[model samples]
Target: MKKNKAHSALLNRYQKLINISCDLASELDLNILLSKIVRAACEVSDAEEASILMYDPNKKTLYFQAATNLDSQLKRGLVVPLDGSIAGWIVNHQKPIIVDNPQKDKRHFDYIGKITSIECKSLLGIPLMSKGNVIGVLEVINKRGGGFNKEDQDVLLALGAQATVAIENSRLFLQSDLIGEFVHQIRTPLSALNAAAHLLKSNRVHEDQKKKMIDILEAEIEALAEMSSSFLDLARLESGRKQYNVKEFDIRDLLIVCHEIIINEAHKLNLLFILDLPDTLPLIRGDRKQLKQAFINLLNNAVKYNKIGGEIILKAIAEKDRIIITISDTGLGIPEDERSKIFEKFYRVKSHRDHVPGTGLGLSVVKQIIHGHGGEIDFTSEVDVGTTFTITLPNEI
Candidate 1:
């Protein structure tokens, strides 16, 4: 009877492991998945709290990326030592450790308790390993029951393995997507350059045709250069490599500046560019340079696609704690069928492609910058009528 019961217990534990592994594999968002992994660790190990510290290979330090009991401020970029701590030891040795009496252990980092405000009497740490290399550490603190046992250790290790694989897959998927987008974006400009060059090489070309071909080559080269720069900038923004230089500034000034820059172009198109902003508008907080780029892109689009004699309005309104800016253009509006795809990377409206020259990345970059500021953007448009883009930015960062 004892042997039969032990076999059933083993089968049940394996079943739970299978279910959790599947869950981890299915989660794709890095932040959400990391939080889930820590939460799952607490659940499977029967611990009071859990945290995940990802290893920074360059810095050789582990930073608190996710936790169950810690606040966002404490978890963000909070670093733990990789020299004398229990987690550090796990990484160095690539093993799972259970400290029933953490006070007695010399490897415990006491400052961690002070930093996170979570008392630690015990800890169970497992190395998040991938391909024989220790990537990070998973730690569960203060078991709820008497003490952590072999079962808890086994379950945590299983969870760690599944999390490691999922994390790698998520990162690689992002890199692959960026590469694919870069390729797709550069193809058109490159083809244009190639065809222009081939035409210039033909001896049958007249003087005027030769000048036109050379102009095409020069224009395409500049376009290609600008596209490459924008791609790298957007990539850095998305990858968290480029930090935002956040500042509080007057929203009216930005609108006025954008109008001044695009007004000439609008005039060339026979369009009226107007800016209507309240003098006492609330001060908005964001990266001023980045926001200016976003504004320029929006206003430029308003003019680029506007019909002759049409009007472009840059208007701003303030709510209780938000500033709503609307860029409305009496331009060639987007079709209902293409509206859903306009924001996608390298996606331009099919009908407008031949008429308008664009790389299709402007709106996407604008969306990214807005979202990074903890704001939202929405738009509404009608075919042949107009399109209005409304951006809501909070007074607070």
Candidate 2:
């Protein structure tokens, strides 16, 4: 009878492991995948809480990436020394460990418990390995059964085994996507450059036409360089690698700076620039530089696709708990069919491909920034009428 019960327990664990594998396989978003992995680790190990610490090989440090208790911001940035912590030990040794008395264990890092205000009685940590390299550590703490046992360790290690592959696949997917986009975008500028060179090489070219060819060469080259830079920025932002310097500041000041940055370009196109804002709008909070980039892209697109003598309006106002900022332009509006894809990386409206000089990454970057700040962005447009982007941001207390 005891032997049968043992076999039954093993079968149940096998089923749960299979279920976890299926869940991880279907998830592609890196952040969501990591969060789910942590939760699954907790479930499989029957632990109260779980977290993942991503190792920085270059820095020789381990930093908390995700956890069960997110309200503890302190843990988010908390770094564990590669030489000191239990997670670090698992990472260094590339193995799994179960410590029933972490308080007495010299290898354990106690500061994490302090940061989250959760007492740690025991822990089971395993190395997240991919291609024989230790990328991170998976740790489940405070097992509800009082102490982590061999079964708990086995379950977490199994989860860790799958987590590493999922993380690598997600990263590879991101890189493959960005690389494909860059390759496709580079072809446009290269074609222009070739055409410009061919025209300038004409034996009977007049000075006027030669000058025009040179101008095209310069503009196309500049566009290519800008595209490369924007691609890097978008890659960093999307990968959760970019650190946001979040703070509270006046939204109007940011809008003013955005206006100053792009107003000259708008005026050069014989377009009217209007700023609509009350003098006493409430302050909003976010990364100043990132938010600035978001506005710059919106206003830049407004001018790039606008009619020759069009008008651009930037307006900001406050609601009860949220702030709304609208950027409207009398420009060539996006097609109804393509509007949904406007925020996709490297997606440019087919109609505007030739007329617009862009990397098609601006709107996607803007969307990433807004979503990063726990805000929402939306738009409305028609073919020839115009397009307006509405951004809703929460007011920070």
Candidate 3:
């Protein structure tokens, strides 16, 4: 009777794994897929916590990619040395390891435990292998009931195999999608440059016309440069490879600095800039530099799109558990039909496209940065009235 019951449990566990494998295969978003992988790892192994450390072959380094019971942002892309880490050992040997007490193990990297404040009493780590190469390590910490056993190792290893394939597929999808869009977007600027150069060399071009052609060449060149830089930023963000330097910072100070940076340009356009902020606001824990970039993007947009004698408002308020920020501009608001697509990459507002000089990639970068910090971004607009972008970030990580 005992033997039959054990067999039934084993079958059920395998059945669950099969379902999870299907789910992982269908997920394309790298962040969502990593979360699903770690969650499934914990469920399959009956462990208290699980994490994934991705291996970067080019850098020859391993870094934390996801975790079940920790703020992943705090540790994402945090490097684990190959010489003194269990995850590193698993990757090096391309084998699994079961440690009953990680504290007693000299090879354990305690820095991670101290940094995350998550005690690692026990661990079972397996190498994630694809195409005969170790791509990463998947580890489950503090197995339930007792120390990890061979069955736990076997199940996690099985899951790791499926996870490896899923990760590679997701990465390939990101590369191909970004590359296709980039190739298509670059052609327009390149064609303009070619046309301007050809016209400048023609004898029919008068002196004034030649100067105009030179101006077009310069503008087109600048657009291509901006487009390339923004394209790379979006690519890094979308691929889950961008390392965020997380820290606690005063939101008010950051906003003030952003306001100062763009106030001159706002004034140059005859726009009244208002900073409506509380004297004191909550300190937000995130990557300060990335957050600064997000704020600057919004502020620049407000100034860029505003009409003469209009007003730009930068406002912030703190809620019980979150910070609310809004950047409003009395400019050409987006049309109702195009509002839904504003955050999409390389999408420019149709009516303003011809007159405005922009790469249409700023909002996409801002959205990615905000989402990466465990925040939300939304907007409300009315044609010829105004537009407002609201960003909500957590009070703590």
Candidate 1's C-alpha runs over 4 A off are: 1-18, 29-35, 38-161, 237-250
Model 3 TM-score relative to the real fold: 0.88
In candidate 2, what are the lDDT values of residues 102-158, reduced to their tens digit?
889887777767645788888889888878888889998888858888878887788
Cα deviation of 305, candidate 2, in Å: 2.6
* Poorest lDDT segment (10 consecutive residues) of candidate 2: 70-79
Instruction: Report RMSD (Å) for each prediction in the order shown.
Output: 5.9, 4.5, 3.0
TM-score of each: 0.70, 0.78, 0.88
Ten contiguous residues minimizing lDDT sum, candidate 3:
70-79
Clash totals for all models, in order?
0, 0, 0
- Runs off by more than 4 Å, candidate 2: 1-11, 53-127, 131-134, 145-151, 198-207, 248-250, 278-285, 319-321, 395-397
Clashes of 2: 0
Q: What is the alpha-carbon lDDT for the whole of candidate 3?
A: 0.89
Residue-level lDDT of model 3, residues 100-145, one tens digit each, is 9998999999976886788999999999998889888999999888
Measured with C-alpha atoms, the lDDT of residue 383 in candidate 1 is: 80
Backbone clash pairs for candidate 2 read none
Report how far residue 292 has shifted in candidate 1, in Å. Answer: 2.8
Best by lDDT: 3
Index of the highest-TM-score prediction: 3
